[model samples]
Target: MSLRPRDMPKLRDQTLRHLDDPTSNLRAKTGDENATGLDGLASHLRVGGLYWVAPDMAALAMSSGSQLAAARWATADRPTPCGLIMFDGGIGHFDARGVQIPIEACAWGPYEGECMLWLLMSRRRLVAEMARANLRLDEEQAPPLLPVHGFTVPVTTQPAPLADLDPSVPLPVIAALAASWLLMQQPNLIDRTRERPDKSVRRSYARAGREDPEVTVVDLRRQYVPDTADPDSGRDGRHYRHRWVVSGHWRNQPHGPGQSERRQTWIESYVKGPDGAPLLSTERVNVWRR
Candidate 1:
């Protein structure tokens, strides 16, 4: 069951009306509490050498999942529904100190940033969803779905050797695959499309297993689903456009002589569309029960 669209504003108002949190000095969106945690997260990422900071969302805007409309959710801001995907194994909540705060995802919603839930999603679940839709992060976007918002980046195509490792492919490749998959999965009223699949990427390949496995590929890309749409996609004619990000690591190892081996390629791209932004059947937001 979900809440009606008209009631969303009321709910938001109700949530914001009360701000007296007796648990800790932390008030929602003050950015102070999350700031500390974000600091901890930053330090952790820097030491781990996962990827670059500053320019990326890991350094830039931080917020909760699909629920929050805005990107930046620092301090005392309207509580953005948040889920912590820790650097260590498992998805669990973390304290301002960046320590894991044991909690259920079901519990994550109601609590503001001060007490957000960090969850570790199952890779198995992701695989199953992909399979259900005949979607493979590895394969190219089957059809109907194609890039919409991004400009094309042309690279002379070449055949990959048999010795080439997949390493979950490259980041740009991951983005393309994910964009197509996510768009197709998004619900449409007219076309009567499917609901958004619950997908999460495990960035830590080591925890994901198989490090430097010459033959096997390790998919360590972390992606986030941002809430957005083309103004026209929605009410214009009742169309829907779903957007998402795919990030991961890949290294193309030159099989033998004449082959050029590249360094760790941390590729990421923004992908969207079903050729045209598919129209939405309805704009009613569903409020599920906790």
Candidate 2:
């Protein structure tokens, strides 16, 4: 869809209406390393800070990955088209040994065939359009758009640690960190550039937890779910469950590439229901390289 600076306000209002609408459903798949669906795809778009329409198709398989490529031209502004907007190959499948290996099989393309219906409105454009919408992407020197908040959950199929929760760091902050790390690791699924908050946001988050204190990182517990169970409401209700070792330590410069000293620890985590119980338990152990 072509959107100009003037049309941003209406777009934003409509986008938010759909996003917040109780009738609008959000669907997602939990596992399947090679799995692709509307939820994850939509999440990627939302995380990029764009408002989009509901996807029309579920998941499908196409034999030829080349012919499968779908492209569309979208204009970011009024005068000229911004760029050639293309579908990044929703998902593809290949038959192997009579088994449909769309996800597990190597050489298979990133999920192909799913289409996203979007009513995107640039955050900057929205602000300019609305006399009182005082938000500026340039003030932050970032993307002029703010991704939707529907898909911020971790993508890993395993649950998070429950017992021995990090006393130093708040659960919410750690969850936020996990979400950030997951997004950073999987740039394809989500871009790190858009998520990077100014130093202030990070400072606010880090100020609460043990800063420059001991650092702990847990081992990764992995789970792969192919047949992701999505909610009936069309929401990507995929659950992530995993265990990891929690470690604590100190380094002269945090995240610094150069040399530094550090400490560590081991802790277990898994998904839990609202009642506060193990959602899924496994023999997986949490350990660090050190």
Candidate 3:
């Protein structure tokens, strides 16, 4: 059945409860690697940041890897501080073979195939509960919840497509495209690494009679380098280059055996201008925090 607006909260709570239950078999089946990426993305999501996934993107994600594909879509926007995936469409469930099937088609309640699903990383309560249950083992040692939780809300109208996305494209390929774009815009932002908790965290775990867990941390940094002199303004004293920001976009990249396969890659946003030149405009990113 289609989710009711009033049932959103209960659905969220129920999903979280399932995820929190260590023994529950009803877990989101995003692959282990994708789950790690989703968990890391969740931890970085700003408290109140809402990332909207267009209907087409949501469909592509579901077709690709369900929750992880959705996560990849959410991160492609590079929502700063933190963000949650607010997908407006029908809910889906994974089959025994790990393929996504519409929830209504399963042995569940009837759904109109029109709804909004809010998916986010349960970074606090669920994580804490799992940690307590696992006794401070590393993530590899103790696989936490899929780290992604979701709920659905019924919508009266169908969602409109935000962009022309090819349903045939896999989510990972799109993710790689988004990553390429992000790398160009803010190269340092992608520097994610896994390391053991700091001394204080380790000590806290020790006090609790547990060992420290390894955590994935991303280093967020942005740098603006302006040219000292305009290359176009040489000798002739003509201002050939003005300060401008290059828009972010995706391009096809060749790969695979003999580079025979082509994949989508994102081009980063960059500033182009002579050194010390005044910028015609600047890009602003809005970040929401708890």
In order of lDDT, best first, we have 3, 2, 1
List runs of model 2 lying over 4 Å from the truth. Answer: 1-119, 130-196, 208-290
lDDT tens readout by residue for model 3, 176-214: 323322332333333333445356656765786754444
For model 1 the TM-score comes to: 0.15
Model 2 whole-model lDDT (C-alpha atoms): 0.25
Instruction: State the displacement of the C-alpha of residue 153, model 1, in Å, after optimal TM-score superposition.
Output: 24
Show model 3 residue runs off by greater than 4 Å: 1-189, 197-213, 221-243, 255-260, 273-290
lDDT of 2 at 238: 43
Q: Write the per-residue lDDT of candidate 1 for residues 1-290, one digit (tens) a residue.
A: 32221222222212222222323222333346454433332232222211111112211111111111111112211122221111112122324254333211111222222322112222333444578789865321111111111111111133222123233222232232222222222232012111211122122334556232111111222333432333223355543354433222232333335665332122223233344544344445332111
Residue 262 local lDDT, model 2: 21
The number of the candidate with the highest lDDT is 3
- Encode model 2's per-residue lDDT on 1-290: one tens digit a residue: 44422332233333334334334432112233312333333343332331111111111112111111111111111111111111122122223345322211000011223212221224444355454546443323222333221111222222334223324222232232222222222222221111133455346447756232111111122231221221122245644443222222111122224535221111112222223323344477443221
Q: Is candidate 1 or candidate 3 better by TM-score?
A: 3
> Which runs of model 1 end up more than 4 angstroms from their true locations?
20-290
Q: Candidate 2: deviation at residue 157, Å? A: 19
